[model samples]
Target: MKKLLLGSMLVLGATSFGAVVEDLQNNGAKPAVLNIRVKGTVVDPTKYSLIVKPLDATNTTDTMQFNFDGLTIGEEQIVEGGYSAGVYQNNILITDDYKIETSLKRNGQNATTSEYDQMAAAKLAYSLGEPQAVGREYRGKVNVKATGKAKGSFVDNGVNLEVLVKNI
Candidate 1:
C-alpha cells in the first residue's frame, strides 16, 4: 500500500508540472488588439498649428506610426505614416517601442518653435505582453525658445500623449 501511494503521488506531481509549463507557453499566445491612438488638444488654436508626428522608424520599435501635425481644434482625423504589425503571437499582434515627436509652429511663420517627444506608450505596451488590455498616457514637459512671429511668447508648457492597448 505504501508503494501504491508513492506512485500516485509521483504521477500527480508530474501532471501539475505539465500544467504549469503549458500556462507559461500560452501566456502571450492569445488573440489581442493593439489599438494605437495619438491624441492631443489645442488649448489656444488661434494662430498656431500643432504639428505632431510619430517618430520615424529609427526612433520607433513597433510597427505603427502616425502624423497629426496639422491637427485642428476638435479635429480627430486619422493619418497613416507607413505602419505595419507583422509580428504576431498566437494571432495577437506584437508591437515594439514607439515615440511621438510634436512641434508647435506659427501657421504663417513656417517654422517650429516648440518640440516635445513622448515614449511612455511604447514602454507600457512591451511590459504588458500580448494579451494586455489597457490604456496609458504620457506627459512630456518641453521648453521652447520663442522664435519667428511668436518670439518672446511662451508656447504651451507641455503636451499629453496617449496610447491604448486592448484585446480583440
Candidate 2:
C-alpha cells in the first residue's frame, strides 16, 4: 500500500509537471497597433486662404511620412479637412489641439490663440486652423496611425485617403 501510494503520487506529480511545462512552452505576445487615418474638411470663415495639406502623398498608397502644407480659404466658403485613423497611435496629438471652447481668435489683446494635438485613437475635435492673419477661420482634419501585430486588432492593415466633403 505504501509503494502504491508513492507511485500514484509520482504519477500525479508527473502529470502536473508536464502541464506546467506545456504552459510554459506556449508563450503569448502583444499585438502591435494596426492602422490610423484622418477625415474631415477645412472650414474658412476668413477672407484669405490657409495652407493645410495632408502632409505628402507621393505614392498615394504609401502610409509613411505624410507631407502636406497649408490649404487656402477665402470668404464664407469653407475648405474642409477630414481625418480618419492612420497606422499609428497619435490620437493624443489630435486631441491636444482642441482644449479651447471658443473660436481661435487671430490677434489683439482678447484674442485666444490656444491649440493642441491629439492621439489617433482619441475622439478628437478637428483643428480649426492656425490664426495668423486677422479674421481668418481655417479648418483641418488630423490623421493618426497605430502599428500592431494581430489581425483585426486595428493594427497594420488596409489604408485609404480621399478628400471627402460631408456638407458642401
Q: Evaluate residue 37 in candidate 1 and report its C-alpha lDDT on the 0 to 100 scale.
A: 58
TM-score of every model versus the real structure: 0.17, 0.16
Cα lDDT listed for each candidate: 0.30, 0.29
CA error at residue 57 for candidate 2, angstroms: 3.6
Give the per-residue lDDT of model 1 (tens digit) for 19-109. Answer: 2122224566755344555754434433322222233442244323232222233333332232222223343333434333333333333
lDDT, candidate 2, at 129: 38
Clashes of 1: 3
Instruction: Name the regions of candidate 2 deviating beyond 4 angstroms.
Output: 1-28, 35-37, 58-168
Error of model 1, residue 1, in angstroms:
99
| Candidate 2 lDDT by residue in tens digits, 1-168 | 999899767656644322211222345453434345666644443322222334333322323232211112211212233322211122221211221122322232222322222223211122243322122222333333222222221122222332222111
Clashing pairs in 1: 51-69, 52-69, 62-96
Report clashes for each candidate as comma-separated counts.
Answer: 3, 66
Point out where model 1 deviates above 4 Å: 1-53, 56-151
